[model samples]
Target chain A: MSAALLSAEALRIGYRGTSMLPELSFAVAPGTVISIVGHNGSGKSTLLKTILGLTPKLGGEIRIRRDARLGYVPQRETMDPIYPVTVGELVETGRYGIRGVGRRLTPPDRARVREMLEATGTARLERRLFRTLSGGEQQRALLARALCAEPSVLVLDEPTASMDEKGAHEAMGLTLALARKHGAAIVMVNHFIDLVAEVSDQVIHLDRDHQRVTIGPPAEVLKGRGSQGRYSS
Target chain B: MSEKLALFAASWELWRGAVAAGVVAGAVCGFVGIYVVLHRIVFVSAAMSQVSSLGVMLAFWLVQAQAIETAHHSEDILPLLFAALFTGVFSAAMAGHASARLSDRTKSSEAFIGSVYLLSSAALVLVGDQVTRGAHDVANILFGNTVIVDLPHLLLFAGVSLPIAVLHVWLRKDLLFVSFDPVMATTLGYPVTWLRVLLLVSLGMVISIGTRTIGALPVFSFSVLPPIAALALFENLRSSFWASAVIGALSAFLGYVTSFLLGLPTGASMAATAGVFLLVAKGLQRLRD
Candidate 1:
């Protein structure tokens, strides 16, 4: 496989010193997609937080290429709408990650912000208040914000959890095209098993009750573990 | 109106330092208040102000007990140092454990803040009673209606506030990002913890000096009211920062002038002026809706 952008070896994840799942090993190469699929009680969020360095790792090691930058797309509902930010301004903040503090975002940065919004099909809504957008639009805007950072690895948390069927598929398609176009690795946490099977290059299936983590191709995982009711809702 | 203006101008030499102090302190508090209001930690401001008041009382008590005679009211700044130290420690605690985190919300945590407020309020009175010059002096400084501003305090207020204002500007986006989306800020490699500590430390300094200069009522008002007034009218947060600063400076200056004219208390007058602006802003917001 190509040089991995992110890899975890015998990674133990949980709160404090306790392990939530069996030790796992995986590597995500550039220009590929890996999905962490689990139900509500599973430790997918803990795992994601550990990877993002928001939470401390319990044991083992997670490595990333030295030059890699991680772009995060948070869930739409997680962002409070009370802030008076335009969609354009919301996307503009993504450049803050790239530009750091104090330094202004150059013209190229502004152009890139506009470009990402256009790519996500939210360009026309740039002037509108971000809070006024529907849930699906907010999700797309978040995606645009993540891409605006031009990260080497893009982490999306429940990217399609709030979208309708059509919007969800459209978002997945965009994710694939953009991943290939930018050569960025995609690590997504998703509850929808069917969608994960279709879009992911590798799937990590999590079972909370049994403290199980199954990692394999989507077809083998789905057939062996049976498709979860993620989309049945 | 002209007569009042003329009276104020005649006393300009006496009042110039105070008016300057008001404007500088008002601008800093107003600007930082944006984060204070947005992050919903106005309680932190209130608690810090009370704690600083306690510090002021402690300074006056110590001077009286030791019979320390200071030149040109050097005793006044003794209170300032005491206040800064007290409030600095309080703000550090707030920033480290809860206030700066912004997202940390729990009843027990709020209870801790509320306890600080009550204890400081009670302690200021107790400490004041021990000052031989009369608690009235300490009370006057802590919550009085009028201000007799002098050169040294004015210079001190400006010296501290001006740098903080510049720091806020230089670090505006970083502060805004943390206040708005701290988790994302953390993921993007920004020093979220240090930024938060810096924010609260800056806030503590402003509140301590502003309380020493204009009294707690106006300081608290300046730190909260203007940002709220700005938020009600502006659809953009950055625009609100500018508006809040303008409103804060205006309210402070107007309150000082009007207090001198109408024989009212300066701190309350300033607070009332800001309150009036808040009412107008809310009215305008309703109309817009």
Candidate 2:
């Protein structure tokens, strides 16, 4: 089998000396979209944070297969509104990792930013300050920022949690398009069941007890456990 | 008439130093102020300025008078440098240690900075009382005499301010990232804590050197008001930086002109000009809003 693009082995997460989630293992394959579905307090957010190395892990090892560039959009509510940056500036900042310091962006970096902005439907809003945008607009702008980096694996934490229904659908469509068009590995922590069922290629349901219940396809995942109902429901 | 011209020429020479000081001070303040305002570290700036006063007083307490003719400028500056380096490092270290240990549970950082500020100011007063022969010289250091900003001080200001200006320009985007979203900065692999520490040290040096022309009191305005004024009008990072420079330079020029015309205190007049600029900028921003 081809090597996974991004893989985590025996990951353990915690806060204040207490383990919130037990040792877990997962891998994200290139061009695949994996949606992590779980109830509240199921350590979904912790899992994402651990993958990004935001907090010190209790125990685990994560390896990126191809020295893959990583991009992430944090939860909407966690972003500060007081940040004084326009969408274009925010998107262009993604090039920081690529360009390093004392070097101006070449034609390619500039083109990448523009293309990402266009793809994310934020081309017209590029000049607008981030905090002034509506929730959905800000979310799209952040995605544009991520895409500017040309990330191999794009991870998002509840991108749709604060958005309205229409916004949620639009965001999911954009995310799926990014995965398809760029061959990016997409991992998202999602609370909504219907949305994941509609878009995800693979569904992994997490339990409060930190057990992984691998649900095969949208048809099987949407069906409630022990229910005799058909997939049409 | 030629006497008036001579006075004008002398005053013009003084004006050059004042303008130079203002530009260097303004540039340093603008760079440091962006992060200061972004991080909500106004108290840190205040602590730094207060601690800087102790540096001056300690210099006076340490330096001794020598023969009048051979008064080397370096001899005078040596103690000030030592005092500045010592007090600045000490206060910053204390604040860092206290914040790391006690800030999570109790409001230790604020308390620590406040206590240091008070202690430094009290120490300055006691040192002033004890050192009588250099009372006027101490006052000059406190509220600098711009009329006499010599070559050595000018070189010193440039030495400290130029590196800060270059770093700010080079790291403009990175600094902007940390200023905007520190969490995002970290995830993107920028070291946030180290950047902050570097900023603190650079800010201390900037204010220490700038204390010569603008004096201790006006240095606060030179550090804060220009950035505030720039933010009032501009939206982009580059534009904001340019606007801040213009505001800072204009305030300094106008302040010098005001003092020259009315025989007012130069430092206070400069600060008043910056304050008025801030008010006008605020009013315009309100109109736009």
Candidate 3:
């Protein structure tokens, strides 16, 4: 197997020194989609945060490729709309890491931002205030911001939370296309079991009652697991 | 008005110090205030200003107790140092508290800030009573005597303000990213905690030294109102930053001129002028909408 883009061994994730999920291990590879599914408070988001080093890991070894760059599309609700930034300006910030500090966005950076905006279908909304965009639009803009960084690992938490069925499907299609084109690894926390089973190559299901995690191909794990208990619709 | 202008122009050397001080204070406050308003930590700034004032009063009391000659320019160092120290400690504490993940049962952070403000205000009064010889000196500490701004004070303000302004400009995007979306900033490998601490510390240092030169009220006003006005006027953050700095500088110059012509308190006039700019910006935004 090609080297895993990201790997976790006996990972324990939580906040304030308390582990919410059972010990888990997984590896993600380029051009592969790994969907994390669980009930509320089942450490789905915590796991993503832990992997991204946003939260503390009680005991775990998370190893990313030395040169892997990360792009994150955080939960839409977590971002405050009170911030005064235009869609273009907000998306332009993704270039900061690549461009380094104290330097203005070069032509290439602006070109990338424009390309991402176009890819995300937010080209028309570039000049609009970020706060004025609807939830679905904001989600798309945020995805554009993340993609503009040209990250090797793209992690998203509920990318379709505010999107409708059609919007969500379209967004996922675009994401899949982008991943294939860029050869990036995608790790997402998703609640929709059907969608997870459809789009993800691998699925990690967290059974809160049993305090256990089941990881395997979507066909093997999600089969006959129709909408019951924590996986219930 | 003409006669006042002639007098003001004739004694340009006399008032130049105050003008320089006002412009520097305005620019620094304008730059820092964007973060303050965007981060929605206005109360933290207020608390910081109050703590800084208390630091100044404590320094004055210590100087009086030691019977040190206040006339010497070197004496100003003691108060500035104390203010910076006190403000730094308070800013660190506030930053830590704000970053903490507390239980729902704990008192909100605003309550803690309020308590700090109340305690600092009362302490300032108590310290002023013991240290200051009369009400005039207390007024000078609270509101600042713009006329007393000499070349040394102007140089000090410039020395502090320039570097901070440069840092803000150079790190504008990183700072904005950290302030607006810390989670994403961290995910991108930016040190969110350190950036936040740096921002708070810089704010404290600015308020500390600026308050010593321009009084707490004007510093607080300049740090808040101009950013708000700029936000009302501009759609983009970068434009808002530049516009805020310009508005702050203009407000200060116009306010000083108003103070000279109308025989009003300089700090209060500057604050009022900033308020006017905010109102005008709001009106313009409304009309555009």
Candidate 4:
């Protein structure tokens, strides 16, 4: 069996020195999808942020495979829409880690950006201002930005929040396809149980009532004896 | 009109210094203003300008207390140097305040910025009163007397601003990334905190030198309005940058000419011209929308 791309052992997540969720332990292997589902303020997004190292972990350890790259799709609401960046320019920022500082994008970088845009169905909106795009379009553009980096670990925060049913389906499908193609470990914070069960191999439910995390395969976690009943579609 | 034109031409040598100062101030502010606007730190810039002006006034007070015959030594740049130093100190403080985990504080960063602006303004007035001998200099510091800008002053402004501008252009992408999304920039291994501090330091240096050369109001206006106008007019960051510089340079030249022709204050005229550009650009944006 392949080694886990990302593993968190008894990880505690929070903000400003306060813990928000119970300790979580999980391991994500390549080409596998892990969904973090919880109620509002259940620290679902905080877990993702902790994994990306945006927020400091309150306790425990997170280990990523050596030389593993991380791609992040932050919540759309967190980004200010007033910035004057085009879809193409926004996506190109994903190359910053790959290209390093003070280096201009090469032709291959541009080609990859274009390919990602096309794959995410945002090629037509490449020249459009990021602020001007609709919610669905913006999500897809953000996904393209994340995918363009070719990360070994892709972490998305509510990738389909505020998206229509069809848009969410398409976005999830595209995400899964990219994960399979790259054999990347995919971790996402999702609220929709049906969508979570459809795409994720494992579901880590942050049961706010019990203040504990339950992690297992989707079938067992969603329908088995440990099922919380709050995740019904 | 011909007489006015001939008058401008006749004293072209004297006007040259003022024109150079205006152009440099406008260009530098235009370039740095993009970060100011994108990072949403206009209030910080405003407060810093006030603090810088207060520094100049304090320098004058100190020089006067020691009975230094500043009138005989009009060539002295000690005050400007002191102003820059004070501005740097204040900028460091502000940066520290911003970076502090202020979850326990009731007042936000805006409140701190507002308090700084008010306190600095009051301190400038108090210092200006104590240093009555430097009253003319105080007036010059408050509202710029750009017509009296000499070659040495213009050179001093250029010496500080030019290299900062080049460095900003060289690191424009990193700067923009850090400004636009600091968290993501950090995730990508960029030094977000250091970059933010660097940006504030550069802003402080510009305001320090600019307030001494062109006065506080004009420096603040130049550092704010042009980027706003450019952002309104252009959809792309590169276009916005270029357009902002052009607009700043043009506004400076035209405002100087207008001030000279109308017998108005040069700095206020320049600031007013920038405001007009902002309004026009905002109108154009509305029409497009």
List DockQ for all candidates: 0.60, 0.27, 0.52, 0.47
Of 1 and 2, the candidate ahead on TM-score is: 1
Instruction: Summing lDDT over every window of 10 consecutive residues in candidate 4 chain A, give the lowest-scoring window.
Output: A224-233
Q: In candidate 1, which residue pairs clash?
A: B145-B265, B145-B266
Per-residue lDDT tens digits for candidate 3, residues A1-233, read: 34888999999876667778788999988778999887777778778878888667889799988878889998888888778778998899888878765668999999999999998899999999888989888888988999988988899899877565677788788888887787788999876667788889999988767888999999877877784323322
**How well is each residue in B1-289 modelled by candidate 2, as lDDT tens digits?**
4665467567787567766776667666765676666556676676677677677666656554332233466655764575469546954675365334311234356677678778877887787776755666556556554545666677778887789878877877776676666556666766655665566677787777677445676677767887888788776667877677677777877776676667777777777888898899899999998
- Compute the DockQ of candidate 1: 0.60
RMSD of each: 2.5, 5.0, 2.8, 3.0
Error of 1 at B51 (Å): 1.7
Classify candidate 4 by CAPRI docking class. Answer: acceptable
Predicted chain B of candidate 3, TM-score versus the true chain B: 0.94
Per-residue CA lDDT of model 4 for A1-233, tens digit only, reads 33888899989887667777788899988778999887776767678777887667999999988867788888787677778888998899988878877789999999999999998889999899898888888888888888888888888888888775676788888888887887678899876667887888999988766787889988877774333223322
Which stretches of candidate 1 lie above 4 Å from their native place?
A224-228, A231-233, B67-74, B98-109
Per-model i-RMS in Å? 2.3, 3.7, 2.9, 2.6
* Pairs in clash, predicted candidate 2: none
Q: Per-residue lDDT for B91-172 in model 1, tens only? A: 8787677533333233255777899999998998788778777755665666645477778778888999999999998898
Native interface contacts retained, candidate 4: 0.52
Quote the chain B TM-score of every prediction.
0.93, 0.85, 0.94, 0.93
Clash counts per candidate, in order, are: 2, 0, 0, 0
The DockQ ranking, best first, is 1, 3, 4, 2
Superposed by TM-score, candidate 4 places the C-alpha of residue A204 at a distance from the truth, in angstroms, of 1.8
Residue-by-residue lDDT tens digits, candidate 4, B180-271: 77667766777766777788898899889899998887888888999999999988899888888778877788888888888998889999
Q: What ranking of all candidate models by TM-score puts the best one first?
A: 1, 3, 4, 2
Instruction: TM-score for candidate 2, please give it.
Output: 0.84
